[model samples]
Target: MSWREEHRSNLELKMGKVVRLLGECEQQLIDETDPPTKSRLKSQISELKGQMRDCQGDLDSFGQEQVTQRNLALTMASVTYEDINFVITALLNQRMISIDGQDNFQPTNPEEKMYKNDLTHNIKFFLDMGLAKAGEVRHFVENNAKINFPDVPERLKASLNTEYIKLIRSGMRGDELFMHLYKFSSHNNPDPLRQAAGLAVLCYFFETCDVFEP
Candidate 1:
């Protein structure tokens, strides 16, 4: 399940517990004779109610945030090689990729290293040139951009097309393409979030193609 789903489920479970506790507190208040004991039970019931309200509020807020993100994701254009390359360039410019002596792209940090390893494994196993390369490119982008890697690829693909998949299969790869796209896209666009969202959309596309195993 996605993190959002898990979070909502947890909130629901907590709310259920709070309700049960509140019921017990009310029952205790009815059975108690001592003034102090009755006061304590009332306080406990009040606290449980407050906790329930807080949990409900958090659940509602999370739902609203999900809707907003979905709308933002939908506003993006279909993913293209240009978009993928743009994200890759942004990562490279940020110094997230390390150039090995053999000219291979390696990770420059612990987080990047993890993503790199994951991509390398997927490429080795999946053996789909378009998907593998695209996945690797997205791994770099998502790691550097600091966005939570999307759980549903289809959600990400809401704004992507399949044109870039064929291009990657036909031997389009590496930092050169990334740099070219970056220069073109960043020429007039100053917003980094826009670039980040593009990368995320590309990630969704690759994932839908079964390239991004993670």
Candidate 2:
């Protein structure tokens, strides 16, 4: 959707029109000598105000839907460990940040917080390796998988390569990066291949698939 064509604009237009209509109706009511004429104008003004409220509700719902769509789209992307690490570091390095909303980056203690901070610095090293390079993310993701789960299936590795390629192009934020990580960590069945995709990410991040924190 074009930015100008969004629901907010429609609401503003509706509000402005309603305000003008209400002002005219109120003025007419004040001028009318007949009680019945005044009652009709008062009813017209109330109807216009009700329509404005409905328009405002629609705008609020549309804004919420946009946020939901963006979240779901990013989740479906299911970023690799490399992408997650890259984004977290970007925030620590004072690059990208949340222009709105809260970032829950608290660590349990000073040491854990320091460790999280260090992870952010390490990401800068990865960033210096040319984050925009086509094969860079793929190489880092595949290498992470190889180091953590040497027995990862070939088909899963290939799918990861494709997803990393897409992730590099989209430019997700730090929190968004981790949110997708959670989405990527879900497995559907006993098929080791499908399960391995999720396991590789958990193992890479938390040192083991079973020990990983949500």
Model 1 stretches astray by more than 4 angstroms: 62-214
What's the C-alpha lDDT at position 211 in model 1? 25
lDDT of 2 at 17: 50
- Pairs of colliding residues, candidate 1: 78-159, 79-160
Each candidate: RMSD? 20.0, 22.2
Model 1 C-alpha lDDT per residue in residues 1-214, reported as the tens digit of each score? 9997777656645654554455456545656899999988888867876786576567667777534332322223123345555644443343122212222222243224325324443221111212223433455445545654443232222212222333345665543333233233333245543443343434334344322212
In terms of lDDT, model 2 sits at 0.39
Best by the TM-score measure? 1
Q: Of the candidates shown, which would achieve the greatest lDDT relative to the real structure? A: 1
